[model samples]
Target: MSATQTAPAAASPSPASAPVKNSRGRVILASLIGTTVEFYDFYAYATAAVLVFPVLFFPTGDPLTAQLASFGVFGAAMIARPLGAVVFGHFGDKHGRKATLVASLLTMGIATFIIGLLPTYAQIGWFAALALLILRLAQGFALGGEWSGAALVATENAPAGKRAWYGTFPQLGAPIGFIIANGLFLVINFSSPSREWFLEWGWRVPFLFSAVMVIIGLWVRLKLVESSAFEKASTKGAIRKVPIGTVFRHHWKELILGTFFMLATYVLFYLMTSYTLAWGIKPADVETAQAAADAAGTPFDAAAFFPGGGFAYPEFVTMQIIGVVFFGVFTMLSGPIADAIGRRRLLIWVTLAIIVFGLTFNVFLMSGGSPRFAGALAQAFLIFGFTLMGATFGPMGALLPELFPTNVRYTGSAVSYNVSSILGAAVAPLIALALWAWVGEPWLVGVYLSVMGVLTLIALIIGKETKDVDYEEAGFSSSAVL
Candidate 1:
């Protein structure tokens, strides 16, 4: 009797008898598919904001004014994200991750699909821009909850010692979604009979097509069981009556640290995707830009204009896609490296590298003396920037949520992540454009990125390492922790 041992938890557990565990594949698919749809919808809107929305929705007679207006609408969504975070996080932290994720996906998908159907400024006057703003806010709201849920679903379910590695699955969605969305846009651009028709009808395809991906994501996510960490928190009666209140009262320091931890990532990501596209694709010479404006029937004011790097849309997109391939690869690579070392240690080095990289933007971008030379420099810049993007971004999937305890993980992480979105993502493109025009080059934009990185590094130095934190560790039950 003294030597007899009780059976392990799995000794008598069968598929039907035991608790429903989220399999690796199911967890990966659920997290990956949700964010894929989320980012795809986001990137499609971002691309359209740069390419079509300025002309179709703003139509302000001045290219820069119209572009700035479009970015204003774009930034509106970021403003709504924290609200979405609070609402969604309340449900997620108290109820479960699966339902919150499904709700977010549905919200984003429907908003995007409706955007495809909205009338342009040419047809509905300013109402069209108003409708676009509303829909963009909905997208932002859905995304606020979507990311934290997905990251938690992945990392909380991960086997011991592999949270960072598993976290990359959802992070992978960024590059995959970007490629698919942009690839489809490129196809529409090539296949359309006329530029006018493409501008009018083709831009709607990606937004409308989000419906299909949303359906697929729903199917995958519906199969997910609530994560074990959430179950344990619930079992221990640690589920707070209001999770965000607990987070604010007890975890305020982590909340601040997590927000800045993500500041550089948001700034760098938007700069790479949105700012660079606007900066790289415009003609550097006024004559070509004016001629292009004339061909498109858009009004141009050459006397007050500043031109861009002069790369054709297809050439630049191909270059960006190539760089994004590096983005996807390095994203996968960063996980193991972070896991093998530690998230804090690896990101410190990457942050320093980002700081250095940002200082050198003028070397590649401003030195485009000849067409051939310019193309090479631009492509190199895209590659290096996006490579840094992947490395910095991949770790965030684990880093942000790990800052909080299980009971308030969703609320804390979402608030932190989305609040940073307001500071960084919402304003990066607009600020970059103004800086590019004011200073007459892209160097200030690079300095903008470096400053953000420096802030992020300072936060990292102040914050503690999250790699050693246990996802399933006991959570606070309306209690204080030092």
Candidate 2:
């Protein structure tokens, strides 16, 4: 089943439903837009978890404890993700990808918007914390269903030999969303009259702004026709009554391999964004923090202070934005390369690079030598790390769904991605933070990343290449059904 021979068949319309024919541009746009909103809402929360949530939601005497608790709430959402996957995956596999994508986007947008309006711990007491956790769970659940649908929208609609290339469009959403979310925060942080002003109101802006983004995303998605793959599945009477049962019963190997396959990507993503931001902007020494606290008429606890890169918020974030540019570039590049070679082969090499990158964390992060020298090294670390992030991430959009038939694809891919979130994203920030706090350095966290990368490499070794999957035929041919 060479791709060229099967691709034309995949695109041919069925008599069951007249295909509205999602145009090339429309397919790319719909795929890119939903995930963009998802990530924007997500990164907004991640950023606040570092800058504002600790002080506002999880206030405690010990800075480390407050941060850990804030991140604990952050991780809690990852736990809800798998459930979201099951619920949404069920509907998506049964109903259609278009409606499911719209539902997921709306869920996330509403949750994020309400979080902006919720009272803080000072105003509403622990209820504020409870509300935040519930909303975070909603956000997680929405995202659990969002990625796979978008990936399917792109890859399922893609032309032969170019599935991976079209897949890159959805992956592009991450860097774009990161830049937009953080860039907006950076702007608000700079524009506020004082740090107090920013803390009081500025952080809420990004969350509330998501409503507008959601409206635009919904419009784009509503315009999308069902992907050809889903139509092919449906027209052939392959739609399952319970996709979850079908997936677990028959595609158990894919579920397991796909979960571990995504392990390193999730770990690296959180580490590079959340953990790095937390560590990148901290005061390098207790004396500096105490001095700032004294000037601001705030109490300082020396016991809770930990050294970091010593860079200011603006300076460090600016560097991160620069690194993410390379992320976007390499993400786009990785797809074409994967299309030329194969997903498994490219990923194996990239995983090896990640393993090597993990070992060099101290080389870039150790806070010695002149401040200028240190800043240069930190910038290099971000650039290098995100470059790897893009390479590893881009192929996943096509690769994951290609592992399953169209009938169970929504369930299969979503389950794998979000389940891995529990293993990787759910804990990476906490683990990195704990190791950083315990050892007073970031080298151990890097070692953690390397270990995860090794796990991904093993998954890659065991998995088969799917560049030539006949998506049209993969559905309904299997006799296994629940």
Candidate 3:
């Protein structure tokens, strides 16, 4: 059957029938709160991996090598995400969305809290790195399950004609989480009397504070009922015994299309946040700066001549926070726009915008001559890149869930979302770093991003527009054999 076909009469709900609702506000709140905590935990680790983990976790060596190793640990979480999806997706589809959401939250929160207490290399040698790896994997695993459940909860309970808007509630978590995570680090970066103190102990505060956030998230999530859609499926005996297997056997096309459709968004997100942090804070290359100055017959001022020297960590993060505000705003706006235009159309236009942004993104970064200029350029990149990110990411919560039947929605969506992380987000920073080091060309990274955009644009062209699809009926009449 075609993806856009209506469900047959025996299984599908009538178009005139009202959608069942437990509480729309409660569902959106539960999804938003849980996702905010999940992303907060994830972003905290990303920030630390860039700023502190190299010095604290790895052997003293070339800073570049150590930074790569830290990112490798970061990628470890992304690698484990798919496995988490499979495990949690099984229970989420077989049992219920509520219980699965609660379990994933606890797993992520405990792992983040433990990371705060872990010993550094000086204290425990290689064992410290090993322990860090284990905790990071736990985090990835939990997040694997968290996002799909949150998206489903919001979309499934959403009123007819408003799934995209409701879906943005969960998408809202990305910027909010980034702001909280970076805001905390910014506080620690300035509050400490010395850099050593900040690196050694101050960084732990955010990770440790995750314990409180997790409790709050759980409280909010626990208050939610299972999604109305899932409840309906269960009542009708539509719930699958092995959701993952069913997804692979029946929805493989959507699984592949969804993964590639999200590739550019993931790539752009990590590059903007993680790789930008790495690039901005790296120490000035004095030799290279001197060469350029001598060749131009201008006196070398270390601050003005080197790109890295011009960027201060606190100031850069503050700029990112400002940009993230716009990201959140646009994220909210993208939903209504998708409702009006269509998810596929909105995605195509925004993705094309990303390709344009990617081609010129390096120009802004390379144009930094003074501290003021550098800060302005950084802000420009963040605002522009994140605007596109918001538009592309906002509709995803609705789009992915709409792609599959209700019986396999959680498993299909979770696997597609997490599997993309492995292909895109898991190694994006690592790949960008390698490109920066090997070719010493920032535009190459832009080209790389554009390539991902092209892939996603193609996926969009080949995929159906799902904004008008009836979520209530799409999943109930699947043809897959048991």
Clashes of each: 0, 0, 2
By the lDDT metric, which is better: model 1 or model 3? 1
Q: After superposition, how far is residue 444 of candidate 1 from its true place, in Å?
A: 1.0
For each candidate in the order shown, give its overall lDDT on alpha carbons.
0.87, 0.88, 0.83
Candidate 1 ranges with C-alpha deviation above 4 Å: 1-15, 283-306, 477-482
* Sort by TM-score, top down from the best: 1, 2, 3
lDDT of 3 by residue, 76-173 (tens): 99999999999998999889898999999999999999999998876777899999999999999999999999999989888788899999999999
Looking at model 1, report the run of 10 residues with the lowest lDDT sum.
473-482
RMSD of each: 3.7, 6.2, 9.3
In model 2, the clashing pairs are none
Clashing residue pairs, candidate 3? Answer: 405-475, 406-475
Q: What is the lDDT of residue 346 in candidate 3?
A: 93
Top lDDT prediction, candidate number: 2
Q: Which parts of model 3 are misplaced by more than 4 Å?
A: 1-21, 282-309, 474-482
- How high is each candidate's TM-score? 0.93, 0.92, 0.89
